[model samples]
Target: MMKIVADENIPLLHNFFSDIGPIETFPGRELNAQNVGDADILLVRSVTNVDEGLLKNSNVKFVGTCTIGMDHIDTEYLQQNNIAFASAPGCNATSVVEYVVSALSSLTESNGLNLEKIRVGVVGCGNVGSRVVETLKRLGIDVCCNDPLIDQTGLVSFDEILSCDVITLHTPLTKDGPYPTHHMFNDEVLSRLKEEQILINTGRGAVVDGRALKHKLQKQPSFTAVLDVWESEPAIDIELANLVTIGTPHIAGYSLDGKVAGTEMIYQAMCRHFGLPSRHKAAQFIPSPPLSKLYFTSEAELSWSMHTAIRACYDVRHDHYALMSSLSGTEVQRSQAFDQLRKSYRPRREFSTIKVLLKNTDSSMHSQFKALGFNVKSA
Candidate 1:
């Protein structure tokens, strides 16, 4: 029998991968060589760092992270050691997109900004950014995209990206490259942002210089910042958190539907790595959301109705509150609570799980809702 070691936070590990071996679970950040020494397989989320220090003496032959970003893992080392590795790309793309929609709804509702009227600038047109562009356009919001790697029409320059009414980041964190994303939005970049513009970063914390962001926000109270990810997380910048319009622990992609999809993706890869039959699927283990279908009355205005429906499915404020409430005490305590927030994050279902029942809404709304990833029908 194979020996497996996995992160305790990975949902449905036993249901999906138990047949392969007996599994041991540990906190992802605390996983050390002693814990994984004899294991043949290791599974993780983004928190665990799979490098030589932890796996140097281990019998672990296969490694997997159930996350879209692989910045935590040392891939070159894995290749040098002949260890097979896999990451679930685009697994939580929809979850992140829905999180954006919910955040946008909150902004539009509170700030009296018309969703259809404002332009949204999306930096990095990867899995999440591309989906964001598609969804925003579906809602009739003008979208400007920027990704240097891809050749596409209508891709905006970095300067144009700064001019949008709302700018959302979805790029991966990179330190060294021709276009390293590390601190892409630094003091100089943050200074150029309009005071009335909205800046949201769900992609990576280091993508924006947190200190610069804090100074900018302090200088301009009207500049709205909605941060889902942060620099030096768990022990995040307290002053910055206190200053931002909305800040939360990185749970944007922690929706139950997305988490399970990540588990299943790595499971399939593990099965292939070990030459075992891949019999399990993600849908088998998913449960229904509390509100399966939500109906909007005919009197419901388009923007208000859309915001109401989206928030009803997944409200971003609760997440913001959860993080703000938990962040207190010493640095270590705040860090621990940050991890705890992620571990005990309230179960969030993706928009695809709930059907939006539109009545009194324009027939065009059906395609719009569908474009936003919700199953829609006439009520």
Candidate 2:
């Protein structure tokens, strides 16, 4: 049997990979060359940095991360060493989208902003950004996208993105090239953001200059910032944390379905690398969701009903509150608490897990709910 060293936080490991090997679980941060030296396969999450130091002397031939981002992995070294690598791209796309929706819903409710009237600018129209655009459009909201990597015929420019009523970033972290995303929203861009705009960053933390953002927030204090990913995370800026509208511990993609799907994707990749059949399936290992169904009466407002169902599946406020409360401690303690929060994050199901019953659903309402990934049933 292949020896597989994996991050303990990865869910449903035994259910999906027990037959393939003898698995050793280690805290992602604690995984090192010493523990991984004997393994033929290595699995990790974003917390575990897979680089030359960790893999130079290890026998591990395959590496997989159960997260969407690849910034944590040293792909060049893996390629040079001929070690196979795989990452679950778009696995958590829906999870992140649901997070954005929930956050926006809460924000609009608290501020009494009309959801349909607000214009949203989505940066990085990849898996997550595209889904966000689709969701917003389905709800009859005005949305514009900006992605330099792809065709920009109908898309807006970065300058235009900054001027929108709300801006959400989903780009990967890249430091080099013609259009680098490192501090993409620096002082210049952030300075242009007006008081009415809501800024959200669920992408890489460094994509926005945290110091610049802090300065902007302190000086202006106009825009609402919702940040899930932060620069210098764990040891993130506590003062800045207090300033944002919502600050979460990078748990936007921590939904149960997304995490399980990530594991399954990597398992399949490893099987292909080893020339073995992938018999394990995500559905087989998934447990019943805590919230199975929700009912909405005909008299209920469509927006209210949708928000209720979305929150029923996953509420961003719980995560926001948890992160905010963790700041009431020493800096080191806050950092430790941040990591602990992620380690012990409660399982959250995606919107797809719940069935929505509408007492009087119109065609438009049904289409909207379906687009939002809910199972809608009409009374």
Candidate 3:
């Protein structure tokens, strides 16, 4: 039997993997040299620090993280030690894209920002960034991209992104490199930003300088932020929590489909490593419910209808604004509360899960719903 050690935080995985091996799980903080020494395979989420200290004397041969980001794992050390590892990437692209769309539409309505003329700069052209670009383009907005890795194909530079009306970051975290993203958005970078610009970060928290961000928000309170990830994470900055517009524990990729995909990917990796037959199966996703067959003849009713449909997926700005309002008195309790709230959040269906039923006639409304990822069908 393969001796496996996994992170304690993942839900429903212990039971799923129980039959495979005698697995021992440790909370990320509990992992140390003494405890991890005997394991041959290690499975983890983003929290556990898999480095030389933890694996210096271990017999670990394989590492698997059920998360999109692999910054926590020491890739150089792993390669030097001849250990193989796999991570689930692009697993939550659609889920995060839907989150961004719902939040943007809702914020436009509430903040009175005109969406038609806005320019959005998306940093990182990987899976998540590409999806956000596609959604923004479909809505007829100008979306610029900045990814050094990708060849220039309608891509813009990092300096150009600073001038955009809205900027969202989706880059991975690297502590040391020629382009170190650890604390990439420092005081100097924040000072260069337009006072009215909106910033969003769903990538690693260290990607943006938290203290600098708080200072910037203080100087220009009108500038907004939608932060799904933070610098210290569960040990997030309390005072800074009050500064940004949106706040959530790093659960941007926590959609049901994303979580399921992560599990399936890890399972497949384990199967291949152990030379075991795959027990993985595809999800039988229930088809989206059809939209209302009754036509909304009135323009007022039509707006409400569209609003409700988007809200079902998620409203990104609402959470940010709520955290901002509460962080004044609640900053000390912010991290724990944030984690609890995320753990208890109800399931949110994605845009692809919803279908639209068209009635006789309005071409504009029909086209709009179809554009929003609703499968339109004649009633």
- Shift in Å, residue 83, candidate 1: 0.5
TM for every model, in the order presented, reads 0.97, 0.97, 0.87
Q: Give the per-residue lDDT of model 1 (tens digit) for 9-69.
A: 9999999988888999999989999999999999999888899999998999999999999
* Residue 93, model 2: Cα distance from true site in angstroms: 0.1
Candidate 3 runs further than 4 Å off: 282-304, 317-334, 361-367
Model 2: number of backbone collisions: 0
Pairs in clash, predicted candidate 3: 205-230, 245-320, 245-321, 246-320, 247-320, 288-353
RMSD of each: 1.2, 1.2, 3.3
Compared with the true structure, the alpha-carbon lDDT of candidate 2 equals 0.90
Task: Please identify model 2 stretches exceeding 4 Å from their true place.
Answer: none
Tens digit of per-residue lDDT, candidate 2, span 87-128: 999999999999999998888767677787889999999889
Q: Is candidate 1 or candidate 3 better by TM-score?
A: 1
lDDT agreement of model 1 with the native? 0.90
